[model samples]
Target: MRPEIIRLLNENQEFRLFVRQNPQWYRKLSRDPSALQSLEKEANYFYGRTFPQRVERMQSNLGLAMMMMEMLKMGQDTVAQTQETFSS
Candidate 1:
């Protein structure tokens, strides 16, 4: 669940969008008794029946994911550029 959620709330929005499009994702979450109960608790305490709260968290995670992605991309690009220069 954690990984999937992270993937969803990522720079690559396809996983998130896929989960949204597929009801199975929600259903699976619902069927997970432990996780569902825990989520309900989180929902009640944090979200308090407000969808915006959950979305806010999701967006925050997405922002983090994007940052990580940018950092990784920058590193890779740097390495590639360095290799090109050194190899030349």
Candidate 2:
């Protein structure tokens, strides 16, 4: 199954309820390419909206990680300089 289809089923209560209520129709769509084209379009719509949010979240996480790395590097340099001053 497509991940988008599974995501739609898992995330959208209305869509999941519709599928639960119309199991036969959903199954028919699962087999019918023409019907599935519309369903895929709906899934694509959801995916399009979700993809950007995911990327933004990833970028935020990456930025935080880089900041932490820089802080760690600076702390290490500070400790190294302190050790050298004490030894001299």
lDDT of 1: 0.63
Q: Supply the TM-score for candidate 2.
A: 0.48
Runs of candidate 1 with Cα error greater than 4 angstroms are 1-49
What C-alpha lDDT, on a 0 to 100 scale, does residue 71 get in candidate 2? 100
The prediction achieving the highest TM-score against the true structure is 2
Alpha-carbon runs more than 4 Å astray in model 2: 1-49
Clashing pairs in 1: none
* Residue-by-residue lDDT tens digits, candidate 1, 4-72: 545433644543455466556565664563454444444355423567777888999999999999999
